[model samples]
Target: MTDLVLGPLLRHVGEHTAAIWVETADPAEVTVTAGEHQASARTFRVHGHHYALITLDGLEKGTKTPYQVESDGELVWPLEPSIYPDSVIATFDHEKPLRMAFGSCRTSVSHDSAGNKLHGVDSLRAYALRMSGVTDTDHEGDPDPGPGMRWPDFVLFLGDQVYADETSTEMQTFIEARRDVREPPWAELKDYAEYAQLYKVAWSDPVNRWLLSTVPSAMIFDDHDIRDDWNTSLAWKQEMEATTWWHGRIVSGLASYWVYQHLGNLAPEEREQDDIWQRINSHDGADEFDATDLLDEFADRADQEPESYRWSFTHDLGSQARLVVIDSRAARVLDTENRSMLDDSEMAWLDEQLRGDVDHLLIGTSLPFLLTPGLHYVEAFTEALAEGAWGQRWTDIGERMRQGIDLEHWAAFQDGFHKVSDMVLEVARGERGRAPETVTFLSGDVHHSYVSEARSPRKAARRRPRQQSRIIQAVCSPIRNQLPTGERIGARLAAYWIAGPIGRLMVKSAKVPTAPLRWKLLRGPWFDNNLATLEVLPHGLRMWWASGKVEDGVHHRPRLITVADVTIDKPTKETR
Candidate 1:
């Protein structure tokens, strides 16, 4: 039997359809069975590895059905008499409230005492233990299971699902065995084989694997998935492009990402529209379409052109919320003369999706749209300085500082930031359709969790009698990786005091136009490794941050600890 290698991951579950993704040991016909509905697809080869994405249709809407995967007609998943709960596909229901879990920056490591001591506890694993009813005690500080007793509609993994640059000891061992450790790119992933192995390490943990199987998930890539500060600026890109192995690294990174992460993010219709998918679907059944060449070419072209293909996707969550997950990292325009977080086409696409009508509008970017006011201003200031705001002599130093300190947020891309901010303001004013109850940006990659509220004096001046939608930014980060103590302290001070005033002064002195909105931190700069859940309510939006806490010195198995709870109140008629 060709045993399942990577996943039985439930992806893109709709009202009457569900997509199940899996990888096998070899080429085989993979069958997924949910209740009486069954679908099968042949595994397609890519770099000698086989993968299949099975789409199940004609299912009842708003129903939950336990699903099982079979390789070559032999049952391989939900291994007979499983100790964990059977993985189920839960379709979306408009009548029910929508809830989602989101976070970023996780590293895969052994979930033992050593890993906990080194990386703090793994919040996602702790959550999985809770969901499986394996954890017994709440423990004094443990978080209460919030709103829904049922599973969330889906989980949004904003970015850094796998760390290609910062490999663990285990990954390093694998690399050393295959390639010369002294070579360029060193321990970083060099090609598709390494990336495939990296993914197996990230997903093979039994508890985490179970969680993925049950929870329908969507994902986007951030810097670490390719390399640190990937596409941060033209300088960084040029430096890497000159390297011998950088080409292979990037091609493999994007190609593996397409197979492991991006493919599952697309729905049936969306997949049909994909150029690569069309090639895969057109195969005449005589031989498998080895996507290695096509993917390599596509990745090369995408890296060179930025607008060849779109990686962003949107999900309409049953009239309750609309999720627009943007590709902030891959689709960046890094030309020094035209520095932008997104290209014009991407920005326009985002604007088109930034409409009202849904109860809650969520824009999921790997990087937070709104940082703490202080940090946001600092980024804006740095961008101006980098662009010769200070003087010709300071330009080089400023550019170095921008890349070194990672001042590459949305704020750093001033033009793009302002354009999107205007779109958000218009959407809030009901210029699109009915104003959403909340326009919230769901993000991660800052390595800290926080909530910030945008207060626009300009918007307030033009405000009508109609209630304006609540504009907020919610961030959850480091589901596994913990920030260093010194960096944590620095982040706290920079966000709270040092950065805002000084950065604002610099921007004003540079003669840059004032921002349309002003924002301030409402909740945190918490450094704990965390996962956040957001629930859309009729009146407003409720979000909670949870972390893994080792209780009573049991370092191996941590309990879920509540970090913070926030509520964004909908504007009432009286308040308006």
Candidate 2:
């Protein structure tokens, strides 16, 4: 009997269609049944694993329908005697408001006290417990959706879905058990099999598993998804290329990412356009068609020639809300002489997407575009110093300092920053089509949570930028990963009132030009394992942060608790 290996992850949910992703133990026909609608697909083999993405169509819009999975004619989903509710396919209504949950930088670890001690708590798991409402381990009562409880229409994982460099204790043991730790790449993942195992470890936790099986999700990659400082610069890339193991590591990273994450990020039509899916979908008379070589070659070319394929994508939600998720890590122009966070082609694509006419424009980037003014200036200064502003001697010092603290953010690539900022300003000032209620940047990577509101500069730095809609940058990071106490001090200090002027002066000394959009940290730089959700309201927007609190003895099940909240109303006056 064929069995499910990993998931039935809900993805690319539309008004009338949805995609279900799964990995089976063997090559088989996987079917997803939602009410009278049923869809099945033959499993495709990649790196010896059998996977299928079943696209279910012809469903009623804005309705909730319970779904089930069967592999090789055997019922598999809704695990026997399960305490959780039946997994449902929820299609959103286009006329309703949009709500979404988002965060990044989660490291898979145990839910025991030890894991909680090392890493605070898994916010995602807590959310599942809340949504699932399973009091005991045994099957008894049915799930209670709770009174007036609002579930997110979708969830976005900004980046660092996996930590390639910082392997957990469990991950290290898995690697050490198979091969000697003394080998090149050491405990780090070296190939596709290792990457597969790592992803299984990350997702197989029963609590988070149920959450994934139900809620539809979208994802992108950041530095740790491949390595610590991937694509920081051409020099860094050259250094890694000289290593014997980097080629294999990178190829496996991209390949696994394509199967495990990127495949589901695409819509039905978009998936058909993918060369990989084209091959997977066109399988005929196959003893499970293998795509190992094909995927590896694609991965290799993607890294070498980023312009050949695009990773960034956009999703339209509700009647006039749009979500644009950017790929900040991989699609970079790393040359120091003309460094940018995105290449020309990627920038052009983004240019086409960042227009107006939307009620709300949500920009999702792994790195926060608007860092607190103090920290934003700090990154800008370091970048300029590293680019020979203080001579070759200081450049060496600057480069070391930048990488040691990981100073590669939007500010580090000012050209790309200016380009995006111009688009944002234009959208905000009604230059696009009609002005949006808000032009917001949602991000997670900094290992802290904060809210910053942007305003046009009183003295025009270069070009005058007027604002009609409120512009905000909200950051919620480290869903599981926790920062060291010492590092937290540096993060908190950067947001101090005095640090802003000091950082600005340093940027000026380094010849950093004045910024068109000036922002102030409105809420926090709180260091906690937090997950945040945002809701588009009639007048404006409302966002709140939540964390997991494992009370006294019930360490296994952490209860969900509120953290902080932010409410943004319309901007009435030109305070700038």
Candidate 3:
């Protein structure tokens, strides 16, 4: 690897200081040169990647601080003309509520024109490259502006940041170059070496690494993080359990996820106290142990003992409120009889976290709380089929479906789904504590983007205003994945006409009770790779989902595919 990209990463303006962490490509003496101060750290291998964490203290809140890093007494990267100074902490008078860009499903691929056609510039890769000051020149001889424009304070990656199953062309090439594809385990990410290479491909790019170095980010995983249709249903789990190479696959996936994704989610305090990585970081490069073995043990433990580790994390931005990022993938229940989207411990953690004391409560899950109307009903009905709830006559059909099954998200695990839904509603109703102005569920998966409103079904019986009884469901997906043209019609047919009425009818037909809400799509399922920014104001929330318009060209900014502003009216004294 080359010691080329230098970043002032994990940067935040704290109450008294501006903090930052950095990674170096070589064991070089790294220094941060800012306005009046400099800080340094020795580049050392943590696990295997070379890194350095540096903090610039005593920064004035909200004041921009320009910075650069030196390796072995030389500036390692070009000074990007448009990079932010150091962390600009939010102050009491900072008017912008809290604005963040969020979305998921990015695949690692070359950013050259050929790869760009398939993957596009909305990718984390391009985002990183742009931030790092890499300019792409078009065939017609135009210089594309770098990533300095349109940067958000944070980018929340919802899931599938690394696809273990749907390996990109770049990832496949890396694997193919190193090993024979015909062998077991080696064929499809069978061991730790392959997993490490996968992460290196995912993060080591000049653009993305720079983006990650500067953008304060938070993330959670979905099925593609491990495999396609991961933990979709009990039968899927059993089938995988019988595979000869699955143990290694799961271990590698979870272990790599921890090192590359989950560990990066921590804040300064948490990062300091983390036991495993701390120890790993302390070890010098000469340590003889193969990290893959330890990684397998860690992955196995994380899967076998979900309670022993925490994949979910919460971020609180002063009184603006809290963001509860839940790990719906790793911490799942795959039992046939008592299935749950989140395991018992994870649910309890979520329940505790949702007992909010923030102005707004944001729940971040990789899977949407509400599925597309058609798929939603299908998942629910399928679970019923498995249990013979639709009558024993459908058992054979259910068995066959279960054998080839993979309908995921909330509806797949009715038990956990119902439990979580009840808790969220209770929180929304102020039963849990001071009800937040809005309970925003942010998610991405299913390769589409949408915004929905959940309205209380009690609207007919009780005359509460619409604002008081509504919760926002926002989804921005595949920040890169485009729906195959062939499948678009089927996905729409399943999501709209067939999925909608059939889903509603099935609920009534099954006589199953629902929450005080019915949902409707307020915005999209538009088949574009997208990125969305959500801004919360004292009065309401303003959200805009943007996707790159190829026709718009580099000169034209990303077009706003959708925009929504929701304001929650406070309950009057008389209503209370």
Candidate 4:
């Protein structure tokens, strides 16, 4: 019997359909059964590894059913009388409240006391223990689930699910044993095999594995998923392109990402639209579809021409909300003369998706749109300087500094930033139909977490009776990783003091136009390893951050602790 290598990860749960993704040691027929209904798919081969994404249809809306996975007609998941709870597939309900858990920058590490001490506790693992009905006898501070509160409807893994650039100790050991550690690219991943191994390490923890099986999840990638400061600018790209191993690394990264992360993000219809999916579906031979060459060509083309493919996706949650997960990394236009966070087609797509009429409008980007006012201005300042705002003499130095300091964000691309901000403002003001209750930008990339709000001072002075939607920036990060003490303190000070005044002055000196809206930090710069949950309520939006805390001298079993809670009002004429 071949053991499963990766997942039974539940993905893309719609009203009547769900997709489960899995990886196995060899080519096998994978099946998913929920009650009397079942769906099966043949594993597709990529670089000799096997994967399948099984889509189950004809499900009742809002129904939660226990499910099992079988490979080669043998029950491989949910072993008989399992200690963990049954894995479930929960369909969407239009009338039900929407709640989603989100965070970024999780590392794959051990779950013992020493591992916890080094990397901080894993919040997702703690939540898994709670969901599985494990008694927290060792943890005194674990929050009891309130009456009738179930697990979040789904989870939005914002970005950096795996750290490809920053290899773990174990990964480094494996690389050194297999090849020369002194080679180009060093300890970083070089090909598909390494990436597959990295993912196995990340998802193999028992508690987290079970959590993934039961909960529907959606994900997008950030810089670390490829490399640190990936595509920061034309110069960075050129430098990487010159390396002997970078081409292989990037091609492998994108190809593996498509199979592991991006495929499950699509509905069956969407999958049918994908070229790779079509190739897999069209294959008729008994053996799996070996897609190594096809995937390599596709990845190379995508890298050479960023506009050739679209990685962004949109999901409407049955009139309650619209989720637009933007591809901030792969779709970048890094030409220094025409630097844009997104290419023209990607920008147009985002513009169309950021509309109104829903209760919530969610814009999920890996990078924060509303950075601390100070940091926002600093990034803008660097962008202007990079563009020779001060003088041509400093242009090259400014560009170097920009890439070195990792200052490329939404604010850095002023044109793109202004365009999206204008669209957001219009949506908030009901220019594109009924304004949503909130226009929230959900982001993670920076290791810190915070909440901020944007307001147009002109609207406040006019005293308009029409209800204007609130504009919010909600950030959650580092589900496992924690910043070093010195870096943390420096970041806090910069956000609080230096970035604000100095950054603003720099922008003014550069003669850049003022932003359409003013924003300020509302909640935090917490450095804890946390995951946040946002719930759409009848009145407004409620969000809280949770962290894993060691209790009663049992560090292995960390308890979930609430870090902060925030409520945004759903503005109405009566309330105004």
Candidate 5:
């Protein structure tokens, strides 16, 4: 019903200021004003999404500035005059340190008292309330007494910002109310209107809306954002294409992907080259930019085969570090004969980006670089079995796994797995980039959280007597959703005793050898609603996970789930 649904939210900041990306249902005038300066953008079309990139340059580094948004001369939403609104306008204060809140997986539910109780005032929502000093007596938290808490430098949303597959009761209600659930474009999101409404439900919550309006956010998508088990493998692709509802589903998913998640993730320079979304942003009338045709083609290709495009991008933060945000789902190569995690072009781009001179080299992907030890070992074993590790006899078992008839992950794709793993290790040794202080892989999508260090035999042999190792793996997932009770116990036990030994023995006994890929939990598999923050400090790299806990029957307390003390010096070795 509103012209815009989600965002004028901020993302991808540099030394000066940050970028703000938004969506408008109707082609309208958009402008962002900070202090006395302003920039305006106009939407050229209606049947698709449009992006307005507002960069507040010449901003005082590390200072918060108040901002406002006007559409066709009327304010879309009220901005708090007391505190600033719009994109985060702060530079990285290395000495002051970075406080980034990272989380994923939220459902589109009401913001009523009952919903707040069930959802427990989402971490992002709580951050917003703290910033604005807004409180709901029904929802409990210590109300900040002072002017209010300062906003985080950035909020890293790993994935499932919206769940296209698992719709909540509210989302389903919208879908059913607007169209026939059994019909085309009705069974699921099939057009821009539906996508826009879906976004409204996902982001229009007052608390989250206020949070996004003020704080800068960076996001990546997982399976649920578009469809269930998106790009799991080749066979999964074939099955989805066979369905009557798939075409429109793909169209709406990718079309919305460009609008909601991908366009905003880009830095200023990258946004310039994106022609499709760029075209949408240039529209002046509703009829001018009808992208139903173009988006349809894009959707068809996205599902029929996923490797033809790239939705990934990278950012370099001066000399401090580089963040490589990869599109793990859409850019997959699913052919059994020639499987690859990234298509040739994307891989090449990634290789080029890998070259740098930064303190930390961070790779952000929705899928964790490491899987649960037991499941990971099993997947690795399955890959070996399919590759004829146990002669041709175990091929049936391999086939079943390949069909994604079972668990699928990096280990399942032997060729891609080895390639990415080798590349990551190479970067860790200072082979690429300024031999970063640490090569950290930041990921989500596993529905559990843990930190693992990658120990390579080659690196071990060449280990500097004085230089500390910098290869580390960190994962934080299911920011709002937790794993089922039944599976948690098994997963925890496997992380300790079962996964490593079983995997190693299978590899040795079958003569399908692999270097030691070991993992140990630095944080958790605890099923508590959680979020994590990673900071680079003078002492070393500090990482911690935070969750809201019902300490007493009266209120929820923000608690630290785990803390990892890492150093640039020699860390004690850990193995599977």
Candidate 6:
């Protein structure tokens, strides 16, 4: 029996359709059935691994049904009398506002007592336990937690779902058994096989697996998903290519990402239009079709020719809200003379997405668009200095430091930053569309979490009336990864106090222009393993960060606890 290998991960649910993805031990036709509705697909092989994405369409809006998976007529899911609840597919209601759980940067590791102490309890797992009503607490008559845990329409995983560069111990063991860990690629992932294993280690936990099965999710990629500071600059890319192992790494990373993460991001309509998906779906082979050459060539092309493909996508929450998930890493223009966080094509696409007619506009990028002013200025100064603003000596130093510390966020790409900032302001002022209640940047990556509020640009304010839409930045990171103790102090200093003045002076010395936007950190730079969720409500747009806490060292079952919460309410009629 070729049992399920990885998932039944629910993805991209609309009013009438949804996608369900799974991997099998062998090539098999997989099916998902919910009540009278069902969808099935034959497995397609990528480098000997078999996967199928069965998308169930034509479901009625706002309906809920328990779904089960089968691989070639074998009922492989639900486990009959399993401890967990049945995995259900819940279609989105057009009347409902958007509520989603989001964060980034989780490391795959053990979840026992030792693992808990080392890495903190997994926030995502804690969330799963809560939503599933399977808390390990011994309290008699176990009281119900709030309904909000299950309230999110879906979860949005910002990035770094799997770390290819900093492999876990299990991943390293797999690498060592296959070849020399002391080789050029070393313990880092080398191919699609390794990437497949990394995913198994990351998502195969019973609790996380259950969470994914029951709840739909959306995702994008960040640097560590491929490597630290991936595509940080032209020089960095050149340096990596000079190495012997990089081509294999790039091809494998991108190929595996497409299979595991990117494909699921698309809706049913988008899937039909995707070139690679069409290529595989059109196959008529009597046996399971192998897509090794197609996947490899596609991945390689995506790496070399950035404009040939795009990873950015958009989701509309009925007419209430819009989520534009931008691909920050791959679609980069990294040449120093024209260094930008996004290419021209991607920028034009985002300009269209940022229009504000809905109740809220949520821009999801892996890197924070509005970083703490201090860090923003530092990155701006670094970019200028690296481009020879202060002459060769400083330029070399700036380039080294930029790549050394991973400074290629939106702030580092000053041109793109200004352009997007202006676009956001334009939307806020009702120039592009009716101004939304809030324009929030939802992001994660820096190993810390915070909320910032952007003030209107001085020139824009003088030219126009006061903008009503609240401009804000919300960042949550490290669903498991936590910053070390020593570095926390440095992060605090950079975020809260002295670095702003020093960074500004440095920026002036480098002849860097002032940013088009100004913002102050409103809430935190908390260093915790947290999962943040936000809900669009009638009163305001509400957000809260939660972390897992294991009481009395009872690490096997950690409970979820809120770390911070905020609500950006709409202005009253007169104020507006």
Give the per-residue lDDT of model 6 (tens digit) for 334-364: 9877888889999998988889788888999
Indicate whether candidate 1 or candidate 3 has the larger TM-score.
Answer: 1
- Candidate 3 — worst ten consecutive residues by lDDT sum? 137-146
Candidate with better TM-score, 3 vs 4:
4
Screening candidate 6 with a backbone cut-off below 3 angstroms (N, C-alpha, C), the clashing residue pairs are none
- Would you list the rank order by TM-score, best first? 6, 1, 4, 2, 5, 3
Residue 345 miss distance in model 6 (angstroms)? 1.1
lDDT per residue, candidate 4, 1-576, as tens digits?
Answer: 556898899989998999999999999999899998899889898998999899999999999999989998998998666678889999999789888899899998788887887788998888777677663432222233632247888899888898888998888987888889798788999889999999999998887989999899999999989998888878789989999999998999999989999988888899999988899888889888899999999999998998998889987796889899999888988876888899999999888888898989998999999888878888888888878888899788888878888898888888888888888878888888888989999998888999988877665426633438888999998899988888899989887788888887888888877887788888998999988889888899988888888888777567777888888878766432
Estimate, for each residue in 68-127, the C-alpha lDDT of model 1 and write its tens digit. Answer: 899989999997766688899999887788889999999988788888777788999888
Q: In model 6, where do residues sit more than 4 Å from their true spots?
A: 136-149, 572-576
- Backbone N/Cα/C clashes per model: 0, 0, 8, 0, 5, 0
User: Which candidate, 1 or 3, would have the higher lDDT against the true structure?
Assistant: 1
Alpha carbon deviation, residue 460, candidate 1 (Å)? 6.3
In model 2, state the lDDT of residue 278.
97
Give the backbone clash total of model 4.
Answer: 0
Mind giving the per-residue lDDT tens digits that candidate 3 earns over 1-576? 236433545544444344455545656667877677787656544345555556566555554455667777887643455442333322122334677779988877665555557666554443443334444322111122333454566789899877787777766787888877777654467765566667677766544555665566677888887888777666667878898888878887787677556766776577668766566556556432234456667779887777778889887666776788998887888776777888888888888988655667888989998876566777777666776777889866765664454566787677887788767777767777777777889999877778876655665326543333246788888787767777777777777778777767766766554544567777766766767777766566767665544333552222223333334443343222
Error of 4 at 122 (Å): 0.9
Error of 1 at 522 (Å): 1.5
Q: Candidate 3 has which clashing residue pairs, if any?
A: 9-213, 65-85, 65-86, 128-207, 129-207, 130-147, 374-499, 457-516
After superposing candidate 5 on the true structure, give the runs of residues whose Cα lies further than 4 Å from its correct spot: 1-4, 46-51, 79-88, 91-96, 111-121, 135-150, 182-191, 281-288, 302-308, 386-406, 458-468, 494-497, 508-512, 550-576
- What candidate 3 gets wrong by more than 4 Å, as runs, is 1-48, 51-58, 70-96, 120-150, 185-187, 204-207, 281-294, 390-396, 399-405, 459-469, 505-516, 551-576
Clashing pairs in 2: none
Candidate 2 vs. true structure, TM-score:
0.96
C-alpha local distance difference test of each model: 0.86, 0.86, 0.66, 0.86, 0.64, 0.87
Task: Judging by TM-score, tell me the better candidate of 2 and 3.
Answer: 2
Best lDDT goes to which candidate? 6
For residues 1-576, could you state the per-residue lDDT of candidate 5 as single tens digits? 235556767776765656776776666667778776687776544365554566666666666766767777777655445343343355555445555667777766654445546554355554455455543222222212333444466777878888777666776787888778777545456566677777888887665777777667788887787876776666677878788777767777787776677767777777767766666555556444666677667766765566566688876555666678877777778776776777777777777777547667778877776776556667767666766778788876775775553455666655666677667666655566445666778877766677777656655546632223366767776666666666667666665568677877766665654644455555555555556666666544666665544334424223222323333332334321
lDDT of 4 at 264: 85
Listed per candidate, the RMSD to the true structure in angstroms reads: 2.0, 3.0, 5.2, 2.2, 4.3, 2.2
Q: What is the C-alpha lDDT profile of model 2 across 219-316, one tens digit per residue? A: 99999999998987776899899998999999999999999999999988899999988987897865777889999999999999998888999897
